[model samples]
Target chain A: MKAAVIVFPGSNCDRDLAVALEKSSGKAPIMLWHRETEVPQDLDLIAVPGGFSYGDYLRSGAMAAHSPVMREVKRMAEKGVRVLGVCNGFQILTEAGLLPGALMRNRDLKFICRDVHLKVENTDTAFTGPYTKGQVVRFPVAHHDGNFFADDELLKRIEGNGQVAFRYAAADGTVSDATNINGSRNNIAGIVNEKGTVLGMMPHPERLIEPKLGGADGKPMFDALVEALS
Target chain B: MKAKVHVTLKNGVLDPQGKAIQHALGSLGFSGVDDVRQGKYIELDLAETDAAKAREAVERMCKELLANTVIENYAISIEG
Candidate 1:
């Protein structure tokens, strides 16, 4: 499967994402810089990785969202190419209007870096098909502005469309408020677009792909994408 | 003409920097302060003479780069 990882200034996770994609798809994905106005022709997947793009200037992902590469990313997403955004990438997607809601500062006003438990709320999307609905997994999240915010109407629309892919869960696998790392409405950690072609999440699945890295729960996320395209 | 564009977070959006400023003010013997909402002021020196055109240009600048319309609001004031 042909894939590409869009790289922006201050994006530190590009290589990690590229490695994960290569291992899963059995082919090295192309690395596209943010200044490029177009993506490679016929790309099966596009990934926007995590980091403090533009030094998190103005707001997280705000400046990076306007980078030249984003226009092409938007066009590609609209054409039904599978797009995945993780952490700051997720913030960029929201800022770019590919997803709804704003990622506000963590409610606690502190940077949180740790493994978080999440439940697979929906497994039917191209990104989450490898997991079963209601299964629990653990992934690491390190972010300063990961709190997701959306109006009630938008939240309802997202929920009604089954866009929620993962929800924060307690260590015992129970969906509870106490386990929510950030004060995201409805305990949401990840979501997909209505068409299920685009996925964005605050957790760093790329960091958890290897057992030596702490857990292998993230392997399935990449596996699902590769399987969907292959 | 020059214009100063002020950009601020919307009412419902959380402002951590503003909150910190408010707390610091409270500790510094500034009482009865209802709230402190911090914002950015960007001064621009433009050669445009028409006020209407200047405002339009500033508005475009705010929308395109100076501000994020989803969470922040911006206003432009021009002076000779």
Candidate 2:
């Protein structure tokens, strides 16, 4: 599967996402910088890794959303290229208008950094194909602005369209306010666009790709992408 | 021309930072604070001389970058 990882000025997880892609697909993805205005049209997937892009100035993912490369990313997304955004990457997608809703400050007003449990809400999408519907997976989440917010009408529409891909849940896969680590609406941890090709999530799957790295739960996501694209 | 823009979260959207500040105020023995909402204030100096033109440009800037319309409302005031 041909893929590329977009790198922004302060993107710390770019290499991690690249490594996960390479490990799963057995081929390295080209690292595209944010300044470049063009990307190869043949690419099957573009992963926006997590980090404090543009130093989280103005707002998280706000400045980097207007960067030159994001214009190309938006173009690619409109053409049906699969896009995965995690953590600050998710914030960027929302700011770029590639995804819906906004990520606000955490409810507790502190940066949370730890492992989180997320229930797979939709396994039909490219990113969640390997996981069973309602399956709970563990991924690390480290961010301050991961609280997802949407207006009542928009939230109902997004949920009605089955665009929700993941929700914070307990180890037993039960979703509740106690498990809503960041106060995301309906415990939302990730969501996809209506076409189901673009995904924006707050957790870091690339951070736990192998069993040696705490767990292999994240490996299936990369595996599913490689399998679907190939 | 100088343009001042205020970007505030829409009502019903939770403002945790504002809440934190409110809590701090309460801890300091200040009372009677009904609610608190925090926002961003941006000041811009523009080369445009006309008031209407400057307001128009800053409005575009706010729509494009200074404010995210989905969650925030922005107001522009231009002064010469």
* C-alpha DockQ of every model: 0.49, 0.83
Model 2 chain A lowest lDDT segment of ten: A122-131
Best by DockQ: 2
Runs of candidate 1 with Cα error greater than 4 angstroms are none
How would you encode candidate 2's per-residue C-alpha lDDT over A154-208 as one tens digit per residue?
9999999999999999999999999999889999999999999999999999999
- Docking quality of model 1: it rates as acceptable
- What pairs collide in candidate 1? none
Off by over 4 Å in 2: none
CAPRI accuracy category, model 2: high
Interface RMSD of each: 1.9, 0.7
Candidate 2 to native Cα RMSD, angstroms: 0.7
